[model samples]
Target: MSAPMPPPTTLEHARWERFKSKLGGWSLTTYGILAFAFLYLPIVILVIFSFNDSRSVSKWSGFTWAWYGKMFQDGQIMLSIWNSLFLAIVSTIIATVLGTLAALGLERYRFRGKTAVDSMFYLPVIIPDIAMAIMLLIFFNMSGIGFTPWKVNFFGARLAVPYSVIIGHVAFNTSFVAIVVRARLAQMDRTLEEAASDLYANAWQTFRRVTLPMLMPGIIGGALLAFTLSLDDFVITFFTSGAGFNTLPVRVFGMIKKGVTPKINAVSTLMLVVSLSLVVVSILISMRSGSEDSVTIGM
Candidate 1:
C-alpha cells in the first residue's frame, strides 16, 4: 500500500484561514460601530435636547413641546425658514437645469479646453468656503451694486433679498449639481443614445425619450443635493445676502452666537430630519432604478 499522503495543504490552511477571517470581520465591525457613534452622537444629543423643557442644552429639565411651539411662534425663525425654503427651491431648479445642460455638453460633445472647463466647474467645490465668501463680497463691493434687496415692481409688486439669496445659492449649487450629474452620465452607456439615433430619431427626440429617462435618477439626485446645500449654506449666503435677508442657516448661526437655545435645537432637529429624508429618498430611487435596469438587462 502507498504511504499515507500528507494532509492536504488546502485543509491545513483552511483551519487558520477561518479564524483569521472571523477576527478580521470582528475588527471591521468594531471600527464601523465606533465611526458611526462618533459621527451621530452629537446629532443624537441635539435631537434629544430639542424636546427638553430646560433652557440649557446641557441639562434636561423635563420633556416638553414648548421648544417646537417656540420655533414656530418666533416670527424671525418662521421668516428665516421661509427664506431658506424659497432659496433652496429656486436654486435647485436653476442648478438642475444648468448642471444637466453642462453634463450633457461635456459628455456628448468634444471641444477645446474641455478639461479646463470641467476643472472650472469643480473649482467651487474644492475651494475653501471662506475664500469664496470673501471673493463674492469683494465682487459685489467692486461692482458698486448695493448688496441690499432689490424691489421689482412687477404688476404692482415688490421683491427683495429673496432673489439675491436664490442667485447666490444657484451660483455655488450649480457646480455641485454638475459634478453629480456628470458622474452619472459617465457611468451610462452611450450605446443607448446611438441606437435611438440609428432608429431615425432626431437628436432632441432621442435625448428627451431615451437619455432623459435614463438621466432622471441623476437629475433628481443632483437637485436634491443642490437643495440641501442651498438650505445649509451660511458662509456664502452671509457675504451675498442683503440687509433684512436671513436664511435659516444664517439665523441659526446668529442665534448660536448669542447663546444656544432649545428652540435652536428644535430647528436643527427638523432640518436634520429634512436633510436625511431627502438623502434617503434619493438613494432609494437610485437603487430602485439600478435594480430595474439589472432586471431588464438580465431578461
Candidate 2:
C-alpha cells in the first residue's frame, strides 16, 4: 500500500500557485500576439511591397509610386474597379430598402411561419460562400437570366454588365442588411411609435417622423455592410460574372494565375483601405446610435 501524501507547506504552496498563474497568463499573452502577427503580417507586407520600385515582393526596394501609376493605367484593372464600385452601390441600395422593409415586417407583426422566414434570411449569413456561388451559378445557368449582358457606354468604352451578378449580390446582401436592421429594431423603444399613434398620426407619417429617423443609423450601418460585402465578394462574383465581365477580385484571381506583381499588391492595398474605412464608419455610426438610444431610454 502507498503511503498518504503530506500536505504542502503554506508558503511553498502559495509560490507554486503564483508561478503557475503567471506562467499561464504569459503563455496566453504570447499566443495572442503571435496569432495576431500571423494573421496580419502578410497584409502589412503586401501593403509595404505595393510601393516597391522593383517587382520582387520578397526583397526590399526603393519606395516609388510606380505600381499605383501602373494600376491606374491598366484599363482592365480600372474597368474591374469600376464594375466593383457600380455593383456595390446598386446592391447596397437594393439590399438596404428590401432588408429594412423585411426587418420592419418581421419585428412589428406576428405572422405564421415567422421562424422559417427568419431562418431563411439568416441562411445566407451562415452559408459558405463557395456553396452559395455554385448554387447561384447553377440557378443562373438554368434560368438563363444572366446569359445576356447589358452593354454600358462609359467614356467611349463599352462594358458588358452582368445583370445576374447584380441579382446574386442583392440576394445575399439583403439578408445581412435585414439582420443588422432587425438588431436595431429589437433595441428600439416601442413607446415612441405608440406616442405617434396616440397623436392620430398616419402610418407613413409616424414612420417618417418617429421610426425612420431613429432607425437611420442601423439603416446606414446595414447599407455600409452590404456595400463592403459586395465590394469584397469574389466567389459569387466569379461564378455569376458570366462571359467577358470581371470584378476586381476576379481580375486579381486571373492576374494571380498568370503571375504575382507589385501592381496586384497595390490594388489589394487599396481594397483593404476601402474595406477598413467602411467598417470603421459603420462601427462609429453604430456606437453613436447606441449612445443615443441609451440617453433616450434614460429620459
Candidate 3:
C-alpha cells in the first residue's frame, strides 16, 4: 500500500498562519519601541533642559551654556565633583583588586564553607542601599571608627574624604566586581591555563601571561561599573560621610532641598555623560576582548 497522503493546505489556512506570524512580530517590535521610549524619554528631556537659557526647567526659553559654566564655577559643586571622582576611583581600584582575587580563589579552589562565603559576598549587592548605609553606620560607631576624613592636598586642592565613606563604597562595589569577573571566569577555557603550566610556567607566570589577559575585559567592565555606582551613590555617602564630606550626588540632594536649577541640570548632564561613556567604553572593550578570546581559542 502507498503511504497515506497528507491533507493539502488551504489558502485561507496559509493566510491565517502568515497573518498570525506577522501580528506576533509587529506586537513584539511595537512593545520594544514603547519600552525604550518610556525608559529614555525622561533622559532626553533632562539633556535638553540642561541647555536651557532660562533657569526654569519646565519652560524652554532658549539654549545656553551658562548653566554649565555656573556648575563649574560653584565652589561647593566643584568640590563635590572632585570628591565623587576621588571616591569612585579609589573604591573602584580597591574593589576590583579584592573582587578579582575573590573570583579567582572561588573559581579555582574548593574549600569548606565556600558556598556560605559566596552567598555572603553577594549580600551587599542584594541589600537595599539604605539598609547597607545604616548597617555600615552602626558598625563604624560600634567599632569605634569615627567618620574621619583622610585629609590630603590632592593636585594642590585640599580634599577631606572620609575613611568610613570609602570603606562603605568599597563594601558594596566589591560584590558587583566579583560577580562580573566570576562570569568571565565561567566562560573562559581552562585548557589555556593547563597548557601554560605544561610549558613550565609558574602560577604567577601563567596568570600574568595567559589568565590576566583573558580576564582583563571583565576586570575593566567591573571597575567601570563600580566607579559608576560609587559616583552615583547618595544614601551610603550621606550616612557615612558624617560632618563636612559631600559627594556630587549628596550635593545634588542638598541642592534639591533648596530648589532645582539649571545648574543642577548641567551637573546632572555631566554625570549622565560620564556614566554613559564609561558603560559604552566598557562594552566596546568587552566586545574586542571577546573577539580576541575567540581567535586565541581557535589558534
Candidate that would win on TM-score: 3
Give per-residue CA lDDT, model 3, range 1-299, as digits (tens): 46434436778667767887899999999999999999999998998999999979989999899999888889999898889888888999999999999999888899999999999998998899999999999888777778878887777668999899999999999988898888779888999999999999999999999999988877887788788889989999999888888899999999999998888889889999998787677657867885444221101
List the candidate 2 regions with Cα displacement exceeding 4 Å.
1-7, 153-158, 291-299
Q: Model 1, stretches more than 4 Å misplaced?
A: 1-21, 148-159, 291-299
Provide the lowest-lDDT 10-residue window in model 3.
290-299
The 0-to-1 C-alpha lDDT of every candidate, in the order given, reads: 0.80, 0.86, 0.87
Candidate 2 lDDT, 203-283, residue by residue in tens: 999999999999888788788878988998999999888777899999999999999899999999999999778767766
- For all predicted structures, in order, the TM-scores are 0.86, 0.89, 0.91
Error of 3 at 142 (Å): 2.5
**lDDT for each residue of candidate 1 in 1-299, tens digit (9 for 90 to 100):** 46545547988768767877898999999999999999999999999999998898999799999999989888888777777776688789998999899988887799999999989888888899889888877777677564856444433323355444666678788887887777778888889899999999998999899999988877877888888888889998987785677878999999999998898999999899998787677668877877333221101
Q: Name the top lDDT candidate.
A: 3
**Candidate 2's error at 37, in angstroms?**
1.1
Q: Please give the ranking of all candidate structures by TM-score, highest first, separated by commas.
A: 3, 2, 1
